[model samples]
Target chain A: MKSAVIVFPGSNCDRDAQVALRQITGQEPAMVWHTESDLPKVDLVVLPGGFSYGDYLRCGAMASHSNVMKAVKDHAEQGGLLLGICNGFQILVESHLLPGAMLTNKKLKFISRNVHLKVENRDTPFSKSITGETIRIPIANHDGCYFADDATLDQLEQNGQVVFRYCDETGAVNDNANVNGSLRNIAGICNDRKNVLGMMPHPERAVDTYHGGTDGAELFKSMVEALA
Target chain B: MKARVHITLKNGVLDPQGKAVHNALKSLGFEGVDDVRQGKYIELQLEDSLPEDQAEEKVKQMCEKLLANTVIENFDIEIA
Candidate 1:
């Protein structure tokens, strides 16, 4: 499957995402720069993690307005698959492609650790493999708390858009498992159409055994199979 | 013309930075501080030749479009 990864000025995870995509799809994904107005034809578009624009004026705020976002938005509007990880998720929310906004961690600290995540809904393209109840991935970020108004949260829940939630190793969802204090323990969610996904965890960091676990490989494999 | 824009988080949203500042103030022995909320203050110098009202309206558009994220922030514009 063809894929492209957007590279913003301050994106440090672009190469990691490229490597993961290449290993999973057996194709070198196109690296689209932030200033470019066009994107190559591809089956998937990825906005990887990192402090885009140095996280200035709020994380992902400045990068969201770049020329490339216009094309990305248009592509997503046309039902193209889009995956945003970590700061990329912030950019998606900032661009209004996804709902809600990411606020600073409730403890007012930058958290960097591996946490367990439960697959809330596996009906989407991003989580169709492994058949596992939970997966372990690394999450590193300062502003990773997900928040929305009551009505929007209810709508997202009703539509089954809440894709992943913080969970224990035993797959229990509770306050204790919510590492960043995100509302409803939400760690990842898709848009209403289920084509755009935004999540805080760094799946790319967990794609190899050398990284201590390959749980993240399932996500990429799922996408490849779905597109195939 | 100059416009000063104040961007603040909406009420009910948790402000970790503000809470940390509030805790530090208390630790420093400042009494009677009920709460503290931090916000951004931005000053813009307009080179447009529009009228005062028009310029203010333009600035408001700027705030809505980019200065503040309406989803989580509220912005107020003051023209001088």
Candidate 2:
């Protein structure tokens, strides 16, 4: 499947995402810069992680309003698959593509570690490859904690939008299993049923044996295979 | 005219930074500090003679569209 990766001023993870996509899909995905309003014809749009716009004025705040985001938003509205990771997740939240907001970690420090994530909703485009299973993905970010009003959180839970929950190695949901201490120990979530996904974990960073293992590879495989 | 927009996390939203500041203030021996809510103050320079209401509306639009996430933040404007 064809894919496109969005690149913003401070997007450090764009290359990693491109490498992962190229490895999985056998073709290099187009790198669309944030300043340009054009988008190549593609099946999926991936918003890779980084300190976009230097993380000034809150993470992803500046990047969400970039010229390309309008196109990305339009593309997403057309039901094309969209996956946002790390700072990309922040951009999604800032752009209102997803509900809720990201806050500083409860401990008020940047955290980088391998985290266990339970696949809460496997029917989604991003998690369909893993069926009711737990996976290990690296999460690294400062403002990763997710915060929403009680009513909104309840609604999210009720709608089954909470796609990934933090879990222990044995796959048991528990507190602190999530690297960022998100409410409900949520590591990732999907919009409505599936099409769009936003998570703090770096699936691309974990997609190769050189990095660690290819456990995160299935996330991309799911998207590509599902699209086909 | 210049306007200052103060953006703060709304009530019921977890404020980890605010909590950290509160802890630091207490450790520094500040007394009677009931709470600490961290926020941002942004100053915007606008054309002179702009109507105050219009300027305020523009600032509000800025906050809602980009400056602040209304899901967890509220902003107020002060013009001078």
- lDDT tens string, model 1, A1-228? 899999999999999999999998999999999999999998899999999999998899999999999999988999889999999999999999999999999998899999999998888889988578999999999999999999999999999999999999999999999988999999999999989999999889989899999999999998887877
Q: What is the interface RMSD of each candidate, in Å?
A: 0.8, 1.1
The reply for model 2, stretches above 4 Å from the true place, is: none
**Candidate 1: residue A111 lDDT (0-100):** 95
Tens digits of per-residue lDDT for model 2, A1-228: 999999999999999999999999998899998888989988899999999999999899999889999889888889988999999999999998999889898788898888888888878888888643788888889999987777888988888899888799999887757667788887888888478899998999889999886778999998887987
DockQ of each: 0.78, 0.85
Say which candidate scores most in TM-score: 1
Candidate 1: where is the Cα deviation over 4 Å? Answer: none
Q: What is the lDDT of candidate 2?
A: 0.88
What TM-score would candidate 2 get against the native?
A: 0.96
Q: After superposition, how far is residue A174 of candidate 1 from its true place, in Å?
A: 1.5
| lDDT of residue A189 for candidate 1 | 94
Put down candidate 1 lDDT per residue, B1-80, tens digits, no spaces.
Answer: 88889999999888989999999999999999999998999999987576889889999998887889898999988888
